[model samples]
Target: MKKPSLTILGCHSSIPTDKFYPTAQILEMKGDSFLIDCGEGTQVQLRKAKIKFNKIAHIFISHLHGDHFFGLIGLLSTFHLLGREKSVNIYAPKGLKEIIDTHFKWSYTRLKYCIDHIELSSKKLEKIMENEKIEVYTIPLKHRIYTNGFLFKEKPSNRKLNMKEIKKIPDIKIVDYKNLKLGKDFMTKKGKIIPNYQLTFDPPKILSYAFCSDTSYHSPIIEHIKSVDLLYHESTFLKEEKNRAINTGHSTANEAACIAKKAKVKKLLLGHFSNRFPNIKAFEKEAKEIFFNVEASEPLKTYYLDY
Candidate 1:
């Protein structure tokens, strides 16, 4: 089965610490790479991870917060300086275009590549991008401002042919093998019928990943992200800090686990930790009480999502 992977760039909330930075990640699936939340020092972390700079064609910004998108201008400028000619697409909130335009205008910078900005609307969950390999949709999140999470779903693969079954029937032409894989029965030249089920097997199940960034204890999002292979939810505080998390429009580890359990996701990854908490294991402990497959995200590590 084909699986997707996520690389953590920065998982710290609000500010950068000596050990952690802000929120940033890379979601790679089926030969396509996406950049999620370009926070401060994201480029440095990307370089540290040895990710090819030009492979990222799309960027998704969760919200307008400084910790979520502060490094965008610097990254864009670096791409320009590197002489990138391929156009880059950015899916973000409405205010980002104006902010980027003003910065480029005053700085007298002209990009060598085209910047395609797709503004996200606050109305509802909708499809943002789709290609042959995968489809992307926006998950409306409850936050201080207009925020959105993203869901990446892989397309179903084609059925595989049983070469041994074909080899037994010398009369079966090469063209008949293609038809058998497409679930079509083959008729021999002598008027004999061969069932497709005997020649091909079912395709592998589809894999999906959901990113739930910077939201409160939102139960409504459960329906949208149900049955995902991997779910990345922000756990900014411990269970004891529930009141503080609520007041700040964030979620505690317990709340994140509740959503993960309710959604029935295969794996849950917790990140966006608060700086006050020195012991990250406390968050994982509290969350494990509700969801067993929980893990605290670490910088420069890759987590695989599979069936």
Candidate 2:
């Protein structure tokens, strides 16, 4: 199966630079795209990347930080201007619903598409958004204020029906074929029960991606994010700024790398850089000392979350 590709829409920290934008990521799963954290100038970046705006069916906002959610209103309004009639669901923190309501109410901006809002907190890891092909869950992260990270995971499922195998079993009913895809035993009318494991092979283990933005140095999450295909943790500062990072409720690059290493994740992506450092290599250098698979994202460059 083809895996989802993740695009780094913006990778700068709280402060924006000419070389970087704030925190925004695009995860392309199946045939649709999911926008995570719509920072400032997101539409321009999307256009520059040549991604269709209409393909974005849902948006997930990490927190109330301006750098994380500043561009959402503009993006939604633009979708309306583009004559979009489908509802766009937004999963955000508790305060987000009021924020959007107040902003739109005062400005009196109506949307062409229905805006569906799903507020996420430090709740159970369950399906927040789902479709026929994919299921998305929320991973709780320790951050200043109320911030919850997102986990986009492909459901562990069965393989396509082997028609040749079924054709040999002329007594096999079509419903039995469907049952095989569901990993269920197929019982013929004459009590010929074919165990699902024998007739249908197990599909490959599902691939998963987890996004952790604006989080402090957290370790308990090792259980939640263990062995994920891809992990994007915020590297807000270098070790020298550990005090500043802790004071500001952020994590240094070394700290982020530590968590990633302990979690045993497949690939580690560090972003959300402070504008103080003119060079992002500082982050990569510090992180590489800890985790082998690390990449500091560049704006508009899509990284495939390979399995």
Candidate 3:
């Protein structure tokens, strides 16, 4: 089974201040890095976090809010300047291509790498793209605008052979073992097909990751984001400012925690804090009241989810 790693590039809500950047995150699947929400200073944050730029083959933007996508143009331009030749796919909402073209056309900078853009939305929780290793889809979110969240799920892999068991089974062809690992019964030259059940264990189920940003309190989200390995949800304010959060289409720490708890995620990461609160501890304290596994994130910090 492949273990996934996640890095928090920026988590503060409204603005980039004292020690925070904005709202960017990086997920490492196998060896591929998938970036979620490239807020301002994402590249710098990646550099500080020691994330390899080239490994970031895909970018999934949560919303068009400046705090989420403002740094995209710059990052694309930087890729060109740095001589990136591989193509990068970006899964984002509509008008992204237009905005990217506007920036490139205005700045008169050409990208050296090909960029494949997939338009996304909440209404359509469709699979944007997939490969042998990972599958990505959009999850509708209730942000202030036409926003959408993302769900990243790793594909199930072949089960490993129980070497000890295989050793005891004499005359079992390695080819038969390979077939069993692939869930196929293989017939030996003599005649009998080896049963997969006797030879190999079932590969573990696929693991999932979900991201929800700038959304107000909502319950349906728990259904879509159910039982994920990791969940990053926006917590722009504390319960004291719940009214303001509702008015602004943002979620408070307690609200975010509630969603996480309902989803039964392995871990709940709270971010996008309101600039009004310089004290980050308040958000953590408030969220812990509802979610036991909840925790605050720091910019450029990475966490590995191994199960």
TM-score of every model? 0.96, 0.90, 0.93
List model 2 lDDT by residue over 84-121, tens digit each: 99898999988888988898889988877798899876
**Model 3 lDDT-worst window of ten:** 185-194
lDDT of 3 by residue, 1-307 (tens): 3478888989887578668789998988866889888888888988988977888789988878899988888888888888999999998888898999888888887788899998775486778879988888888888778888888888888986767766666667676666678787655557876676666777776778888897998787888889998888889998999899989999999999999988898898888988888787888899999899878877777777757
Higher-TM-score candidate of 1 and 2: 1
Which has the higher lDDT value, candidate number 1 or candidate number 3?
Answer: 1
- What lDDT score goes with residue 90 in model 2? 94
Candidate 1: tens digits of C-alpha lDDT, residues 108-146: 998899999999986478999999989999999888889
Alpha carbon lDDT of each predicted model: 0.91, 0.85, 0.84
TM-score of 3: 0.93
lDDT of 2 at 138: 83
Candidate achieving higher TM-score, 2 or 3: 3
Q: Point out where model 1 deviates above 4 Å.
A: none
Candidate 3 lDDT for residue 50: 90
